[model samples]
Target: MSRITTVFDKLRQQNRKALIPFITAGDPEPALMVPLMHELVKAGADILELGVPFSDPMADGPTIQRSSERALKYGVGLKDVLSMVEEFRKDDTGTPVVLMGYANPVEAMGYETFAARAKASGIDGVLTVDYPPEESEEWVEHLNRQQIDAIFLLSPTTPQARVEQVAKMAQGYVYYVSLKGVTGAANLDLRDVADKLIRLRSRIPIPIGVGFGIRDSMAAKAVAELADAVVVGSRIIEEIENSAKENILTNVYRLVRSLRSAIDEAGSKH
Candidate 1:
């Protein structure tokens, strides 16, 4: 089984929710990327969503957009992110790492080439924000050949027809964007999310991970009550962006640990 499937299965057995934390691969700097990944794992992240820095990231809000800008300032690209993953694999081999970014870089690298290199670098999944399920058959085929999960995004606005499409093509888990706006927007209604998830669950057989607008432990805990996973991005990037160079890892670890504890509390209730 793919690392992602294995991890989710294991979590299911333990009645625990997966905590997937996101970070731009070369955010603070390329050198800190691998270490930051390790720190996240140490702080109880079940899976890591590593962002590839792109010049144009339309789905991301200002917090994550700033993260991409900082990483791009050092000229970090798709290959550089893959290399960082390779370096990370030297010490840790089991944690699933999902590449979360736009389709432009993957298309530029070619799907076949990108899939092969991603497999070689120990990637477990890919979440290309712009690759709608309708247009990703070949893309899914390439990753399937490499035994890597092709993750997809489903938003509140996603239709039932598209949900069925994603259910057929998607591996790993489906990311449900809880809010209608970009990554950092707020005012998430748990009742709305709960209602949507009930409808999505009937169509999607795979696990659902809720993200976007989940900024604190309270939000994470609430989402964890209804979803198999809770994905936190902008909040973590904001933690990195606001921390001092020397204290970045420490601060992020503390924040993620709190999230972990909160999610676990919800899981225990379940």
Candidate 2:
């Protein structure tokens, strides 16, 4: 099985919800990236979503936007991010890593070229925020050819037809955006999202992972009760930014472990 499938399958077998953590590549420093990844995995992340810094991240909020800016200031590009993945694969190969970002960098590198390089670098999937399903057919084809997943997002406001379009094209798991707005915006109704998932599950074969505006253990547990996976980005990013001075790895480890426990509690109820 592919790394992504394996992780999801394991969670399914155990009747558990996956905990996906997102972190910007080269944040704090490029050198800290690998160690941070390792820390996340050790703390109980089922899957890792690494954000590639982009100049214009339209869907990101102020926190993620700042993270991208900091990463970019350090001269972190797509190639550098992929290089980190290559190095990460040398020792740690079990955790599924999905590259999440905007598409301009990939377009600059060429779709085919980017897919090939991503596969070679041991990346399992890609999620370009701005690339809708209609414009992603070619990119999807290229990624499939390279054995990489083309992950797409489905928002709360997405119509049935558009949901089907994304389901057909999406590989691995589908990212269900909890709200219509950017990453850190407020107002996510878990019960409403659950209803949407019920509708989408009828047509989509893959599991659904919900993200955005999930702030605490209560919220994480609430979503995990309904969705196949609970994704936490802004919350964890906030923890990192707040506690990096005291001890970066230690703080991240504690936070991830706490989130893991929350997910575990919800997963065990099923």
Most accurate candidate by lDDT: 1
Error of 2 at 12 (Å): 0.8
Q: Tell me, what's the RMSD of every candidate?
A: 1.1, 1.3
- Residue 190 shift from truth in candidate 2, angstroms: 1.8
Please provide TM-scores, in order, for all candidate models, with all chains considered together: 0.98, 0.97
Which residue segments of model 2 deviate by more than 4 Å? Answer: 267-270
Residue-wise C-alpha lDDT for candidate 2, range 223-269, written one tens digit per residue: 89888888999878887778745598899899889988998889443
Question: What is the C-alpha lDDT profile of model 1 across 1-270, one tens digit per residue?
Answer: 888889989998999999999999899899999989999999999999999999999999999999999999999999999999999999999999999999999999999999999999999999999998878999999999999999999988988887887888888999999988998898788999999998998888888999999999999999999999999999999999999999999999999999999999895433
Please give the distance, in angstroms, between residue 20's alpha carbon in candidate 2 and its true position after superposition: 0.6
Name every residue pair that clashes in candidate 1.
none
